[model samples]
Target: MCPLFSPPLFMQRYQFVVDFVQAHGSKKVLDLGCAECSLLKQLQYHGKGVELLVGVDKDSSSMKTRMHSFAPLSSDYLQPREGPLEIELYQGNVTQPDPITRGFDLITCIELIEHMQLEDVERFSEVLFGFMAPSAVIVSTPNADYNPLLPGLVGFRHPDHKFEWSRQEFQLWAVRLSELFGYSVSITGVGALDDAHTDVGFCSQIAVFNRKPSQNDPTNQHRSRGEPTVYRLLYSVAYPSLSDNNVLQRMLVNEVLSQAEQVKAAWLSGEWAAKMAGAREPYRQGGDICVSLLDVWACPQVKHLCGTLRRFTEALVGERRVPLTPDRQAVIVPTEEEDEEELDEEEEDEEEMAAVEARCTTTTTSVATEDWEEEITHSAVGELTACHVLAHD
Candidate 1:
């Protein structure tokens, strides 16, 4: 492990797989030899476009003990989902031919093959490339050549590793498999050392295998096969999605009320008043206070909310005064005027604030005042605030 990399070597290996899936838009992914489901935990959140993620490990007890690590959390509901994501964990051997996991977009066997007996390696390749042929596969293992570089280390990096392959040996094995399975293989590595021993290569060597597109491609041939699942399903979960009406309704209500309360707090704060002191128009028009749509988008409290979800919040602000102008840039919030009957409306507003405080416990942020001040100074506060308002129409 190098001092420069904070996450160290093992995490870098996982990150490489994540970056690959994100780049290629792999919708279905399988992780072989998943210990404690660490890669699954990372892939669930960071693996973009990953709709179906499956993990298999021979160590059933390890995967079972950490099943909760990949489950959806309380905060997952606050944000909208990219799409439907389903994760499943199973206990099984990698060399077995499992019908359920076949024809995936991508498969990863990270730092796993070195632990297998020499004879099982051939069976593992036959299962992955011939039977369960995915479009792409990534495999990483220790580089025996780099073992001597470590000051106190001797022999293999891990005691459990049956055999460690030198760079040439790993590439020879990979090239032979690529030829036999009709796939293309490329070699890369991680945990690079300084210039002095660059020739020795990375501590961890990797082989990326992509099935060659052809009439005889194994993946195409096996895409429709219906083999029974060999792995035992230990756990499964589907995350909440905006497509669900109840979920969307709850999220929409919480954000609208939270934003409304935030706007109100900003209007009352002395910093907001000081920022608006030089505006050309009065802060309030009749009974409505002006708010910037841009500022609302930038507010740290709701900053994590996506632009599309914000549109829903913008649309569902019923009965309040948050009507967008023709340009769809600005809005307004209605307040109480000096009329005697308006006292009732003011009391209602106070009660509404109290309710907002109770339902939304997220701390309000005042640090964005300077951002508003900078943008407001460039144009009149009235014009900017008029562009976007968070209120019920």
Candidate 2:
């Protein structure tokens, strides 16, 4: 890794795969589920010395667009001095072998397995290990056990994921597959690993399988002459910086502040007043107002606002100055037992409130009167303070 140019953690994983391929002196390489061919681009940019680079994916549209966009950016670095790099794009399924020229030096299926059904994984493994007969195969998937470490994240990382495997589940599958095929498998991890005992720590798990010498020999009975259907050519260009965390962070902050200002204007424009006037007795107990405010906080227009939401909640909590309920005007400290129960309930409520606000913040373009604008600012402060008081009780 370059000290001056730090790629994001996910990109680092792709780099790791490339490094492993280069270290083993692999020349012919193939990537399965190569969406946007980002990894291939990175490999070329990093000068991995791959003579032939092939990428296959089910998404024909994206591949076509990427190929067109990146053609101008493709440089001499992607081509070897001895000969031009043979870059190929194919649309194919992993479960079934296609007419792709076999006997690759290295094959990679990074973050592609979890999209498959367990049965499909079995078929894919057979096709890869038996037919492809690469010297080395690298596969990566999410470690479900590490999900707890991500704040406010729930279920799978992506909705398209069929299922995520824990470390034990992944290892068990790898061992079984290695036994079925004539290969030796090693396991390693990617992404941050903090607190090893309690968490799997690494966000993604990887398996590297090296074929037995006899298995790689051309005389082996496992070798197959299947060819993959020629896939449509997409962009074969230099890797572009797809994303920057710092730039995204700045954009999110600016967007959140802008939305907040819009919210302030909406509040001053009597939007809340109109809703409050129509509310039933139960809804008038600040529940509707809390929901309304949270709707503003959770708008999807702002990107990566989980940390921002936490900060906003903390600020509101710190500025709390009034009681939550109108009837309970006086502050009354509770006994230890009561305090414990109240604390638990408060924590649950706070989490719920945060989730609601984080997912539902609405935007409005209505103008505000000067007097109402001042009142709305003060009212927002008071409401947030009251919500904080409710959460602390």
Which candidate has the highest TM-score of all?
A: 1
Rate residue 105 of model 1 by lDDT.
Answer: 90
- Error (Å) of candidate 2 at residue 241 is 26
Q: Where does model 1 exceed 4 Å of error?
A: 1-7, 216-228, 243-246, 249-393
- Candidate 1 per-residue lDDT over residues 300-368, each given as its tens digit: 534444445366445545524345434444345556534755567668755754453244222111000
- C-alpha local distance difference test of each model: 0.67, 0.55
lDDT by residue for model 2 (173-206), tens: 9998788777899988666634553456466688
Candidate 2 ranges with C-alpha deviation above 4 Å: 1-7, 69-83, 193-199, 215-227, 230-393
TM-scores of the candidates in the order shown: 0.65, 0.54
What value does the lDDT take at residue 130 in candidate 2?
Answer: 78
| Number of backbone clashes in candidate 2 | 19
